[model samples]
Target: MFLSMSFRLRTEVEALNMVEAMGAYSRHRTVSLLKPRGDGKGYRLVIAPAVSGQAIAFGYMKSLVELAQQKNLPICDQCRNYESKGGFVKHGTDTSGDLENLVRSCIVEDVTGFMIAKAEVRRTSAIQFSYMTPDIDSSDVAIDPQFHVRAAKPGEKPQPFQVESGTAIYVLGVALDIDKIGVVPDSNGKPKIVVANRAERVKTAIQAIAHLLEGLSFGAKKARYLPVYDVVGAVAAISHPVPFMVSPARISKDMDYVTKTVLRASNYVKLFSDAKETIKLFYMDKENVVGEVKAENIDITKADNVSELVLKIIEVIEKSLRD
Candidate 1:
């Protein structure tokens, strides 16, 4: 069943900036915000749906492949620094091509130029996220001035460092086609089984997404802080494709209403499936987390079970993670 997941991300000081121009006058420093649809200016946080989907795919694949890429170390297996330690393997699939195959199928290889050529586009990413708009009206937003001191070397002079901070309840609605991807037995019997099925593929992709998004930091000064998501998603009782993006206004915070809206919307589109929303919270750090986001929150780290939930939500469509 195709399922839609939508939720509010209440972020604090998520430092996002797409700089068009720069100057030494810190007060004049500009940060991008979501402009209305017809406006010409682009916003970094309120991203385009297509780009968001690709970014999701990239995030997911990057999470899945990082270990192998790190251990494999060098690009071009021919590099002299490369020793044939036979350690460049993920889950026993030691070959680089195998890893590349999985990555290219779902994500873009823009992580690096070498990965770009190798990671040719395969199955288009099924996850579609809408332009994440703030739940509250833009006029209600309050921007606070952040002040800092520029650390200068002996040869340089100091300057003022100021940035504006804004907080909003942003909403993102995503539709995932879980019925399309599944895991089937490997033709070559390597790595035990293949994750190419639509159900399995979607599961893997979502898991990757959950991993990437957890403790995600973006824009400038990424090290300072991260965004937190009060996430919710619904799975259908049957295979109903949520192909369209519903705006935040039309969405209901109530879980039942959310499910019904999805059902009705799908029916109108002549698509049929049942789904329900499961609620959870996601955060960045595992320790000292002084913020309000709880540690008990799901999908906290790479080690979390967030990935398995994808399969759980699609149990009506496919029961097995590996088949």
Candidate 2:
């Protein structure tokens, strides 16, 4: 039930609030907010969640889409390129349900890479940027759950290690992996389980959630909550700093509905930013560069499997880190 609500709220009311909240989140997080693209048909809000930018972006966008739908606002078009029309946009030409025609228009535009970047381009929305470091005093750092310990055991089902050390330790150079699985043995010899990706899935999830967290914080004007696992992910630590980016856009046709759009956008950003930030603060080094992205052009046709490609990227990152 809680899970359902989480997903629903994220896709509805919370989404509307994102537009109004963007400036505050950016200012407080101490991260960077890239210039919003206002050129072409719509606006492009891009963000880089040093920790989980991608997941964060997804969460924010998903929620915003729902909110706009409920309010009779133009549905948001998820485009791979800000300047390209790969998604749909609404035009007043259709007599279908106001939202329905809007959706159709968007679909048509998306196919051609011509989207209304901003619903009303005459007005410009202002966004803020913020970045904050953990209260660590040293260059070398490691972050573990205040309650998590033990290298993940191998298997389909995994159990948390009896943490001999009560406090989660922070370490540098250990990378977080999301969507990974680990198994522990039961008394009968059956392995209990925990699963995520080996490494890439972990990173992708991490980036996704981090951007969400930052968005939430920027909007709520207070600390936001997230699942603890998201904070740690598969990465145990980093020796470099990763850049985080947050960008919010209305999923609606007019972009006039700031409440739902902003809310959803902020939530998504905060989810990703918090997890990413926590990992960076708890585990990564000052020198390590964290990568945050507000927007990217995703070519679904170009990849055989989006999920597989993401994981493969993880393999590459892992290999690079190990070297």
Best by lDDT: 1
Ten-residue segment with the worst summed lDDT in candidate 1?
A: 294-303
- Residues 1-323, candidate 2: write the lDDT tens digits: 00000110111111111222322122112123333344645543333212223223333334334333444433344322222543222332233333223323332121112223344211111111122111121221222222323354576444342111011111111122221112223458674432222232223333332334323422221222231211211111121223222112112233311233223334444555634422111111122222231222110111122233334444444664356
CA RMSD, predictions in order: 10.8, 26.2
For residue 168, give model 1's deviation from the true position in Å. Answer: 0.7
Model 2: lowest-lDDT 10 consecutive positions: 1-10
lDDT of 2: 0.26
Give residue 58's lDDT in candidate 2 (0 to 100): 33
Quote each prediction's TM-score: 0.51, 0.20
Q: Each prediction's Cα lDDT score?
A: 0.38, 0.26
